[model samples]
Target chain A: MQDDIVLKTEDLTKHYGGVHALDGANFELKKGEHVAIMGDNGAGKSTFVRQITGVEQRTRGKIWLYGKEVNFTGPIDAREAGIETVFQTLALADDLDVPDNLFLGRELTFWNWLGPFRFLDYKAMRQATIAGLEKTAVKIPNIKNTIRNMSGGQRQCVAIARTATFHSRLTIMDEPTAALGVQETEQVENIIRQLKSVGEPLILISHNMRQVMDLVDRIIVFRRGRIVANLKRDETDGQDVVAYITGAKGDDVADVA
Target chain B: MAETSHGTGGLTFDKSKRAWPNELNIFIALILIICIFEALGQLLPYMNGQSLLFDTKGRFDSIFNEARIKIIILQVSIIGIIALGVTQVIIAGGIDLSSGSIVGASAMIAMSFAQTELVNGNPNPKAIFGPWAMDLPAIIPVIVGLLCGMLAGIINGVLIAYTRIPPFIATLGMMVSARGVAKWWSRGNPISFPTEDYAWIGSGMMPVIWFVLLAVLFHIILRYTVYGKHTYAIGSNEDAARMSGIKVARHKVLVYTIAGMLASFAAIILSAKNLTAQSGMGLVYELDAIAMAVIGGVSLAGGRGSIIGTCLGMLIFGVIISGFTYLKLDAFYQEMVKGFIIVAAVVLDQWRQKKAAAKT
Candidate 1:
């Protein structure tokens, strides 16, 4: 319940029928801290992120954000509560242009008295989109081109920019660079660095050990639905994190339940 | 990169890379078809030369053949109403096969409410209801027709969104059921003798007026409204829409419901204009409406069309029908040629998509 603790979760567990996708995860993230979630496939890394972002319902868990206990019904609720996420799927409407995709769900509207019949404020959204892109130092050749025509890196940058544009309290990204080329990956990493320079808190889920070590202050390793190890970047190496991920090392937090 | 050279304000637009707007392309097609018919009018030997859309002999007050133009506009207007709704449904990535049947059922029900108490100083012989329902206001019948459409749309939306049935199958079921309702409404007999107020709604060029008004309203709605954006977003990528926190299922219901209301409105106009309604009304009208949307450049794939394009498509349909009759072509040939045009439009759509994809 401290002001510095941006997000805290206790006993977060999700079971898909017989499969325990995520179990007994007790985690905490402080303000301005960058944490990396590293695990192999089916190690509950994505599942854990989904639980926090309300993309899926948790079987039983308590999540506290900025000292307030909250339960999200859907992704929208989480987003409204200042939790922005760059999902692994890179959820961008292919036929919509940059501004449209950036303001997809939460569009700015004029004619407030018209209630549900309000019109989209295209000019305002375009301006904000331009500002967001500039803030992230991302250059797009054409803001009017649909996402379908954009390069993979440009799409990824759009998603990241969406998270940044909203001035969210917490940002979570899952495998953002998985599909990008070397240069594109560097561009995404630079965006992340920008977030850090602004003193923003972030949770990055990546499988690349090098990326995890280079970008995050702390690395949380998950193995078989539980937090196996929480290692500081300065105190631990890739081998130590992998040892815990592969279940060769004992659990660092004994009281996960 | 050449396309990105044009700067407006601080941002550059790839205007050169952009193809002509779909609506513009459809408008051009409409003009080309008219020109072809005009050429045929001059080239063919029909005892004497006659213009297709012009009054060469100065028979009318206007420069153009106002009579033929009126006929073309009037013939397409009723069905064009249904196409307006079908365009939205298709843009939302769904199909509604029930629109035509909804039209039939709604027209029959609405006319029953709209009938006068006495026909020429006698009890109405074709009344579907008792005197209590007779001589109702025009708005009563209009609302009744809209409700019929709305109910059918809700069922279609629920089935497609919640039950997860394919839109084609769900709407097809409604299509058959609605047609049955139309027949059962009055034992397959036509309902006639609509009240004077109701009759005025569809008198003469009123249908065309209604079509133009609705087309303009929907065109703006699709272009500038939040509802329009959400509809396009859902059609463009449903998963992305959901992840962005859009209520996909509920939105689907809204889209189908609106489409149903439009179809019902079309039915009301058709029945009022005819001064009667039959169970056989609007038979195959759904296909015509859909054909209009597709021909206008509304993609069957969804999320990539406009109301303007559909309107232009409607005009093309009107021209083809009118042109065929002017050319003295058999009615049967119209069907064959219509089929060819529909297939060609879809082929063109696929080519456009591929070209857009290749540009990136």
Candidate 2:
């Protein structure tokens, strides 16, 4: 929660063949800040995240992570640079058990080279998995169940747990609770609060006004590939936010949004 | 759906601890097929009028019957070797139709170099090879066979990975080209009379032994290794896997190359077993191998299935074929029935997936 400027984008723009997805947009985030990004379905919220997370290359722009200019060719590059994303699709291997899914790529192992053939430190991994689930308050009764067997809420929780475990400098959740029930959504909101309390920077892409207002310190309204209004949580009401999201207001500010 | 728990807790049903009886399911299927055969033997007058699994006549050690079983396993094992790698390919969300063609091509290419120079101390009339290829170490033909497989596999991997061509199309193209090369290798004649050392490679049930051994080895690798996990992950979700820092394209190439090499090795075994290599050696073998993979519970959709399943699938295939022969059914009828079973296996797989998806 040190008020250090951790990430900044300078005239960040992206285009798709001739479609101006993001036109000379600029944004910034300080350390430990929870920022909410809101926009209509066609608006550039996802495109912006894609560019920033290196899921897609920007047609034209510069991105700064940890105040250093960085160009990422792919999401792996972004991840290696300390960016973890919980995409809306919930990219989880449905076939694997919970603990296995938790530590998918970067598995913790003993005996280095012999790790694959060597015995997995199951107790340690299981214990750590349990602790992670507990910390996120994502109760699934059994951690051995595969994601395919779990409820939507549990799957969402597992994806979130991955972010927590990785401890990325910037965590981008693309509508993390889009498919959850009321109770599960509330649980996710609570986890977001826990994230805020720990001073972890998060970029929450959501349409839920109540959740956004309750969770974020600042709201960045995007419309037609432009950041129209950057307002403090108290400055913007849900109605104004909806106006921006739906092109009712802030149309005059910029055609990009 | 029921709630489950873990550790020393009440109502704790750890799903992982509750191992899936996938192998058991396969075993049950095998038994059911055998039971049908037994029932037919009793009902029909011309079924050798005996038990299905055992040779009731007591003419031999039942090892003769066992030998037939071994042969079926042996015949499929060569292709089963290729199927091992193919199972991984299919599990990783791709199909390799070219493996069959790779077998024929690699077999022809390797045998050309395996020809003996002196037939009774004179120049061998049937030799397509130069004198340099004659009397080489046993390792030469084996190495040549393996190299052809490796080369074919690498090409498959490159086309599928780098060019971003669909696996089916790329492998289909390879199928035609490889088979053509097989015919062209010895000008449409069969290559025969390999050295004594080469013959030992596929002597008796060694192909089956190698198949079983490779299946076990690969099964362990798939279950325990990083390569295995990544293969599953990539199959499950390529985008997510890539984002997770797995080199998806490179791994895919490696997988296909391995598959190609396995098919060629199978070819090498086939040549040794038959003592000849004809252009038509591996014709329709791909379909049978794929059928075995499907019957083993390998979802063509990827991200599921096991080597053990495929092995069981091969057994099922063998039993069905054996049943047809025991019943004195026409060879044409058996071929027709086999085609039906392959389609049926796919349908069953689709239905099971639908049911699972519905439940979820």
Candidate 3:
């Protein structure tokens, strides 16, 4: 049963002077589970995700991925360890086309047998990008278009598609559907469901209640930089999560840490 | 983040009125400037009508005034090489102020090695070093100049990338220090009489040849290589690039080093052409090269420049200067007009960016 946990963070904390952006956050995601992190704007939901994804270093924490303790100094370390992230900003180079964005740092290089003479395998990257987008059901008609020329929904889809390219042990999404339309939100939900079906663990940070209820298997509610409730999908409703988030109920912190 | 999401609506771009490539617009601007000069040649109240770019009388080897064209190319080529490196630097979201001084400093050091072993079958009179260092192979001075440039560039890179000194300040410091080194070497005296082989490097149209070759090579690198991608990525948004796992610091260092080496090579060519090395050889060359890059369409804002644009930029620069001289414009007026053109080019660049933004 312990082997099923894909990600676990022990006593994760962050501080900025007198402000505790995140204090003693403890969470876990099981293999094939889809967990939604929910809270108000300043409740440390994004901060908790930041620590696990190595977007920022925690003041103190022990992150265990695949049952081994790891300290990721930066996002690159976490990414190389099979932790893919869809940042709120998407992290795409706006001037580059879709294929270039998809393979920004980890580009496929051909003629590797010739050492420094190795060149970008653009054809291979393009094909792989097409396949990834198709698998995610993203409908980008012109793949050569740069990100600066894309719609909000299309940009979000490209980010999701990029994360889907490799064998990811865990995927962390920060407001993946925040800027999307209703139809696009539904499409993203389908992609998250597919990830669940394929036994890929997920950590989705979202504010949309309806989408969260429809897409997630578990809910972790935060308030005042602390975890207030942990409820299974069938055990709680939107109102119950909101109570925990707003301190109308479940004000006593859960033994989450 | 808001700026990047609104994609360029590719289908709509084709339907819009402004469908020409941006580089084409620059080309048209260059031609328009030529026409303007040609009209001024006819309109000005002078003793007689004259031609700026065309041969008024059949007195040269080419359709154009061969001597004047040669002078324009010779003047632009050395500076154009530096602009190539500056293009990369600006594209990487950094500025280099030391390139001119690097030229000066490297010229002094390299020319010392390029001195001929003999003076009319006697021991060399102007040798900077003992005979052991004199009469060295031509490659020796070329290597020395390039290494001096590389070392200066590495220092600039380290200061900017690792120490977090702002690029302008760091390279500015290098500028002063490098010029100082130039003056210090050979105690403000000029070094001349390079060997035949060394002199041949810059003799008669060779600088122009070298400039064109480097321009093409760098154009390919920026267009098709991973290094180009990373450079654009860094300039476009550095924080985003770092998050994406591109080694931002190392790449920045490499960009500056390459820029340094190019400036050094420019210095070597300058010395070879003049057949001497003076501490003041490359003064203001940095600013000229930057002006060319900016004029060509290498956005100082970074991530949005190209080498071909810089080449065209050099041409525009050359034509404007030569045209001014041809019309017998006062040197003072020429300086003022050149400044005006640089400002106008930047304004045009900003307008294009705004139009692109509005379309999205």
Candidate 4:
């Protein structure tokens, strides 16, 4: 239980029947340290994240967040514990507008003055959403328009903005720019950079080598359900990370030089 | 940013040129249908100068035929309650075929509790219980009906949510099972001779009043509450909703339970209105309610509709049926026309959805 350790997972293992999706993964993230988890498809990077975020329960694991041992039953539990996540699907209600999507599970509601009736504080939520968007520099033409009407880039920005809206202790993004265009991807990367400047810890899961190399303080590569390499940004290049991802390097430790 | 078009399903296609909202489109069609009926009344030789719904004769208290108006509203009100629940369910991306059967079961069970101790000067022949159960309070019967509906709904919700069964299959099973329960309750016998207290539940325009009140309440809930937001979210994208921390399964169950309770309420109204209840009381009511929601612009694909739209659709339904009867159309022909209208409304909704999709 160390205050400096933002997130720590000990021997996290997830088994889908007899198949091992993620196995005995040991990982750690320091406060305000931007980290990347990179691996090829089916290399269990997503599975590992899912377990940490409580999208899927691990067979055995102990997750500590902000120096407190926590076991999330589902994504909601993880979220309530101050772990904000932008899932691969973006997890946005497409029929809802930008503000509504931003406040999907966490809405501003007040009890009726006279009765037991509860009312959603749409005006307040809208203002907060605007302020949050401005904070992240994620702009949309209209917050009234539903997500279905927005372009791909706008939808992604809204998703990322939602994670930023609340003061999350740890933010996890799974392939945040996978479907984004060059400009949209750049926009997302800038938001990530803003998070770094604000001294916020981040765990970004991506296959984009350039993105991982450019945005993170460290890279953790996964191969066949296990963490194969943990390399500091100053000590690793794209070739070394790719080799680890492709399982060309077997050792868990890599050269620091 | 410049383009703004009102599309069907309450969606605004900002990039498209222009089109009417689905609700407005339905409204215009409603007026057109009325005009068509009016014209037919004047054109046909058998009509004898009688209008479909207007004050052509000027004999009634108001412009419209008061009796006909009463009948039309009453005809749709009881089932309208069920539509409110179904609308929520559909918006949450599920269908309920068990509503009609739930109506049947609830009506029969509620009526059994509502029986008087005496029938026409003799001991109650239709009584399903002992003297202690006779002539009980109206609240007892209403509660019984609601609980029965709630039980059925819970079952439907649990099966669909926890078991991961498709909504269609789970509700279809409930439909059959509930119908069987209705028939078995009194061995297919009809229950009648309710107490005065029970009879007052659906007397006169009470059913219509109930429908309007429930519609308004649910409208507010759907438009200005978290419940409404979650329903739309789940229907729009279940996976996204779950990831956002919605209790998808629990919400599904809650939706179904409410739907069942509404269906049960409809049954109580119907039985009270008729002063009788039989196993066949709610046959096809589910389809009729679904049709109303669809006609009102409720998308079968989920996550796009409104209470106002459904209410308007109910009126349209009532008017069409009344118009057909007034025109001296055969009952058989009316059924076919109703089916056609349902299909046409869905096709219209589809076209609107496609237009919006293309614009974006």
Candidate 5:
């Protein structure tokens, strides 16, 4: 397989009126790479993902998707460009059913205007939804159930299924298993492993050191707004990562390598 | 296994669908209203008590008085038009208290345009309008009314969505301002004697027809269309809706605008039916319409209710009024009862919400 950089960000920065929410940051991911971003509460880990995924605009930077420089104005734009993000807040509409939530903004329309008027092609969507669930190996008794009725893990699984169903080129998950219990978290981890086997790139923003160590191939550390250090899974330990998050390193000056 | 998820889930799964038991409260209230009238009929000497639904004389159709039923429906039908718009607003996590004021203002403006020239040479003295607006087609007034509503809705939407004002405050500001405009239009005197064509639009059962038609249309829109989905999405969780790529602000504007237009349309019907426009025509209509929405089972918190519920609520309102007349209840008592019903409906809604939350 040709070595291709599936995603790249350069000099990405965001400022909330002098807060310097995200200072200059640079990152890269290969087509099948699994990367984990680790940082403290105010380390700008979320800020970086928010900018890259178009949840928030960068004050200055360029995001290149598949080698083309991109500036997405909104999350939908990023989604259409094959980037699906599972935000920390779990932006799923609780009122909607599993299938409806899966194909919410991007509803699979049949017969164009004619079918939209007659029926939603629920059968097609349901079948496809089941297939998507099977691919993720996330079992649910029925697909007709709403997110409000589902467990936290089940809801998280449904959210992940959306990414899998769309076949997004890159998936950005922010604390996907934080709120989940042991069994549910294990289920999510298995799904993550399945994604790894499928050669799909994933960017996991997580604080769980064990999860980060187990699921990702590379660790990218952030302090304040800039990327402080980059380490491969085998090369670095958790203490080294924590030292950077705590700003113990004297590398305060941001010099892009 | 220890229960470790968000909530306990093991329970007997009942296949029979859960009914809105709150609807039963409204039903019980309806029965109680009938009993009140039945008791009053026993004490009152004037009340004949020939039938609960029929008129005083107890005649099947004629003496029973179709006009009374028509009047109650007619009264509600006009404001019910505004309610349709308000429903959309509420569903989208907003409110439109200005709808009633929009009605008053739009009625005055539309009537001014729909004025007829004194054909018999009486020199129409009540004419605040010029000869250019004289004897225009009925459609002219309707279009004008609709436009007025649209303008009010757009202003409310812009203020709330773009300016980031709270819906209640924004629409309340419009409410006061619109009513002020209504009073200023003819300077507090009633605008009388609309053109015959204008009068025909709201005359007889037309208001009811329009109300029903608009309600049905909006009901479908809320249930089946992209607009409907977006409305629920925003109402349920606005932040999530925005993150989902919905143009939240623009859609909000459209929803409020639609509401404003509905109010204006009701205003047109009101002025036409009465053949007169008054500054106080739509006073207190906002409350009544809101009461109807609440009584119909619409959750005040938003994202949970139906148009069918509103329609049923309107029917209940009509029935209660009719029932009071059957028992020869005082007008003051009827008002008191209506007030109580509104409060009861809200309480029932709260109870239902609590139940749902408990389930979660």
Candidate 6:
């Protein structure tokens, strides 16, 4: 338990009735460090993320955030504990506008004494949304337009902005650029760069080697439900990471029980 | 910062691109329907050219036929209350087929509690309970009605949310069960002789007053409250709502429960206004309430409607029903025409959705 280690998981395992989607993932992320999780399809990358974020329950594991052992009941619990995630699906309510989607679960309200009858502070949420979008240099033609009308890139940006807007302690992105075009992908990468500039810690789950190498300080490769290799970005090449991912190379460290 | 257009040739803020609000469109439809009926009043050779809404023949002091207007408003008001709740359910991507049945069951139960000890200086002949239950405060019966509706709603919500049952099937089950309860409550006999206080609740345009108040309250709730936002969010994308940390199951329960309470309130008003309750009360009223919501522009697909639209839709229904009678149309023909109108409204909604999609 050290202040420098932002997140630690030991023996984290998930089984879907005999299918071990994630197993014995012993990992650590340091304060202000960006890490990439790379694996082939069904290599347990998303499953590992889900376990950490409490999107799914872990069969056997321990998670420590900021050096305190914590268990999350749901995504809301993880979020309130200062973990923000941009899921692979983007997770935007299509019919809601930018501000509405940004503040979906955690809306700002006035007339607090009204309890359930309190009114949404539309002006405040709108202002914060604009500021958040500007922080990531995301351009949306109309913030008032519903997410249904926005381009794929705009929707992705909004989801990312939501993570950024809340000033969350840890941010996680899963395949954010998988569905974006070349230019949109660069736009998302720039947002990640902004996060690095602000010295915020991030965990990115992606398959693109070049983007991973460029954006993160460390790369954690997953192979068949285990962490096969942990490579420092400056000391390893894409081929080395790919070698571990495809099982061409053996685990660099013993797989934890 | 230079705005990057992302190859869209620069995003243009075209005023014309903005579609008219759905509520405005509904309001316009209401006016058009009224105009059509007014034109028909002049065109149809109905006993020497009588006006439909206007007192053109000098039948009343006001420019409009005050009596006909009152009747039209009064007829729609009771069901309009139910439509308010139905609008919320539909907006949250759920349906409440039990609302009409809830009305029937609540009316029968509430009236029994609201009964006076003596009917015209004699023991209450229609009393379902002994003197101990007789002449309770009007609030007691109202609360009884609301609790009944709330309980029914909770069952519907739990089935849909926790059990993962489709809203249509869950509510349909409640619909049948509630109607049975209504009949079983008094063994299929009508309950009458409500206390004077209870009777005053539905007397003389009170139903209309209640409808207006509830409509305004719900309109604000839907437009401005956190509950309203979650309801719309859940309807728009339930998984997204969950990921955003919304309590989807609990919220569903709340929405359905509120809808049930509204339906029960409508029942209370109906029974009080009639001074009696029958097991047959509110038969097919669910369809009428849903029709009002649909006609007002509440989408069956959910997450894209308003209380204002439903209110305007209610007015259109009232006009159509009143207009048909003025035109001397048969009841069966009116029913057929009402069915056609409901179908047409949904078609129009689909068309509008497509057009909106195309614009983007």
Q: DockQ (Cα-based) per candidate?
A: 0.47, 0.37, 0.37, 0.34, 0.26, 0.41
Tens digits of per-residue lDDT, candidate 3, B1-360, equal 223222222221111332355677678888998899889988997917688777889776767866777888888999999999999999998999999999999999999999987878887777899888887899999999999999999999999999999999999999999999999999999998999999999999999999999999899778777888898899888987888888899999899999999999999999999999999989988989999999999888787889988988998999999998888878898779888887987898888778767765
Residue A250 in model 6: lDDT: 72
TM-score of each: 0.94, 0.90, 0.90, 0.89, 0.86, 0.92
The sequence of per-residue lDDT tens digits that candidate 4 reaches over residues A1-257 is: 66799989888889999988888888889999999998888888999889988878889978888888888888889888888888787788878888789988777888856231367899899778777776677757666888888788888888888767788889999999999899889978988988898888999999899998899999998887888888899999999988888877866533221
Q: What residue runs in model 5 are displaced by over 4 Å at the alpha carbon? A: A1-3, A11-24, A59-61, A108-128, A140-142, A224-229, A234-257, B1-50, B54-72, B119-125
- Cα miss at B161, model 5 (Å)? 1.0
Model 5 docking category: acceptable
Considering every candidate listed, which one attains the maximal DockQ?
1
Is candidate 4 or 5 superior in DockQ? 4
Q: Put the candidates in TM-score order, highest first.
A: 1, 6, 3, 2, 4, 5
Q: List the pairs of residues colliding in candidate 6.
A: none
Clashing pairs in 1: none
Docking quality (DockQ) of candidate 6: 0.41
For model 4, residues B1-360, the per-residue Cα lDDT tens digits are 434312111222243433346688779878888898899999999999898777776575778777788999999999899999999999999999999999999999999999999888899888899999998999999999999999999999999999998999999999999999999999999999999989998999999999999999999989998888889999999988877777889889989999999999999999999999999989999999999999999999898998888998898999899999999999999899999999998998899779778877
Q: 2 or 3, which is superior by lDDT?
A: 3
Q: Global lDDT of each model?
A: 0.89, 0.82, 0.86, 0.87, 0.80, 0.89
Looking only at chain B, model 5 earns a TM-score of 0.87
**DockQ of model 2, rounded to 2 decimals:** 0.37
Sort candidate 6 into its docking category. Answer: acceptable
Q: Which stretches of candidate 1 lie over 4 Å from their true place?
A: A113-115, A248-257, B1-19, B58-61
Better of 2 and 5 by DockQ: 2
How well is each residue in A163-221 modelled by candidate 1, as lDDT tens digits? 77788999999999999999989889988988898888999999989888899999988
What does the lDDT come to for candidate 4?
A: 0.87
- Per residue, candidate 5 scores C-alpha lDDT tens digits across B1-360 of 223111122211122433344556656665676566656665676764444544666466475556666766776777778777777778787877888899899999999888888846786777887788788888888898899889989999999999898999998999999999999999998887788888988888999998889888888777766677778778877887788777889999999988998889989998988888999879878887888888888777777666777776776787777777666678889889889988988898888767665774
Looking at model 6 chain B, report the run of 10 residues with the lowest lDDT sum.
Answer: B4-13
Two-way lDDT contest, 5 vs 6, winner: 6
